[model samples]
Target: MSGWLPVAPCTPRDCAGHRGARRGPLPAAVLLVAGSALTLLGVLCVPAVQLLGAAHRDRLIRRWAYTVVRAFGVRVLVTGERAEHSAGELVVANHISWLDIPLVAAVLPGRMLGKREIRGWPVLGPLASLGGTLFIERERLRALPDAVHAVAQALRSGSRVVVFPEGTTRCGRGPGGRFGPAVFQAAIDAGATVRPVRVSYRSTRRGPVGVDGAPTGPCGGPSADHSGHTGAVAFVGDDPLAASLWRVVTAAGLTAEIRLLPLIPADREPGRRALARAAQNAVASDSAKRPAVSVHQ
Candidate 1:
């Protein structure tokens, strides 16, 4: 790995814990089948979806992304306002699981900024390529400028670009990795508005407690204990993709919450470093006021 590439301290052994409640083998198998089928369906539709108008295509993509997450038995709860459908906005969120990709796209369907290695993954690689993902070479610091330029060009062409500036996945229970400043330059260069989103996971189960020993509630309600469920979805260092997928399907009452924060005008920020810091701080702040949850299509 390159020195510039951001790495989280979390490992599968330490960060990913066994949940107290899990679905039976049969139910988990069914969920796995359904999630796989939905993903393949999205892949097949990509070609046709590309021919549609931008607004129509985005609507279809948003619907497909929402379904994919739900197919894995994960409830999607979105709070705060999404950025306007108009382009030239950069959507930045905390990195937790592979599910974060679809979770973010479910609300703000846009061109994704992903690591270059993901372009070679099994089913998702082709789907991401067809969906217009911008891949960056995280291992090569020399390629950073070119990657930023590509993202800036996309933004300038009136496209909403979504990026996880943390560079790698982190367990969601604690204060996770900081946002890397490089990608923020693309937003500044293109004069795009930065929309910071906070992504967190909570469980509806009663028995499993959080890392801090907070009590959990029953199904369909809020729980102070989120660590157990959050671990079920976390994709951290040295964790196999298959293991993560299995955990997600087997976990019960898992909910992914997306909190969209206020937008920061890139032009107003002193530079990319300040822009990155502002967005990170906005996402890190926990709101005391409860916001109305938006239904995911």
Candidate 2:
């Protein structure tokens, strides 16, 4: 085991362990204490954190969040070069995992909308608030105006903004893998071009099959994952945070691949289901079409 691991198991178990070391620790005590402290402090500094302009604050918060995610060991693999979009353009992509934030932030390097709970997280929360991320509490519904404003303000300020219209992770299965039409309103409201991106993780591209990961293709998989329970980084808006974090902490490093495509004009914005279908295709298309893994896998 020792000798093989040193060689890099190229297997999920080893990959998971590497991820644990990167994310920090696996025990609840560590996360609990750290998370609790941060939560408390974020509340205390709420007023001060809100002082910066949304873009300025979220820039800082995103940096902090990306760092923390990196420290946990989730490496982002981006492909199909990211094109510059006008300030009001909305960057849309599939929601694959919770770690999507750091994974995307590492390269996309922009402001995004997060769940309300993320806004309430301790040091990280305030840091995010300051970084210009708009944290929305869906249950409250009334907060939609504020959330929209934050996104609008960011774009209006000439900063790029992003949204995950899937509204949740596919968990790699079934109907909802497609993006919901309701979520599309944000980009329309902002009058932004729709730049679609694709994302996926594979067990191996150069390695063997023993460590099978989710298989994706130009049109999503002909393959299937019947074990359809949510993955560690549940992208679904409703998964419990504690459980989600636990899964992410315990999982191995993901070979994330992102393909950023051209900006579609409002006149060209694909209808409800088509938008997600386009992205889904893009994610796999980029990977399958690659002559080589151009970006780090």
Enumerate clash totals for all models, in the order shown. Answer: 0, 18
Which residue ranges in model 2 land beyond 4 Å of their true spot?
Answer: 1-70, 140-150, 174-176, 205-243, 270-293
Q: Give the per-residue lDDT digits (tens) of candidate 1, residues 1-297.
A: 653587777767666644545677799989999999999999888999999998899888888999999999999988887557656989999998899999999889999998888899988999999999998887888899999999999999999999988888877765667788888999999998999999887666655433322123222212224343456787888989899889888877788888888889998889999999999888877661248458553
The lowest-lDDT stretch of 10 consecutive residues in candidate 2 is: 3-12
> Hey, what RMSD does candidate 2 come out at?
10.4
TM-score of each: 0.90, 0.60
Off by more than 4 A, model 1:
1-3, 206-229, 288-290
Weakest ten-residue segment in model 1 by summed lDDT: 214-223
lDDT of 1: 0.81
Candidate that scores best on lDDT: 1
Cα lDDT of all candidates, in order?
0.81, 0.51
C-alpha root-mean-square deviation, each candidate: 4.5, 10.4
lDDT of 2 by residue, 7-112 (tens): 2112222112111112335444465455445445544654775687856655655455445454443445555655554667667776656566656665565667
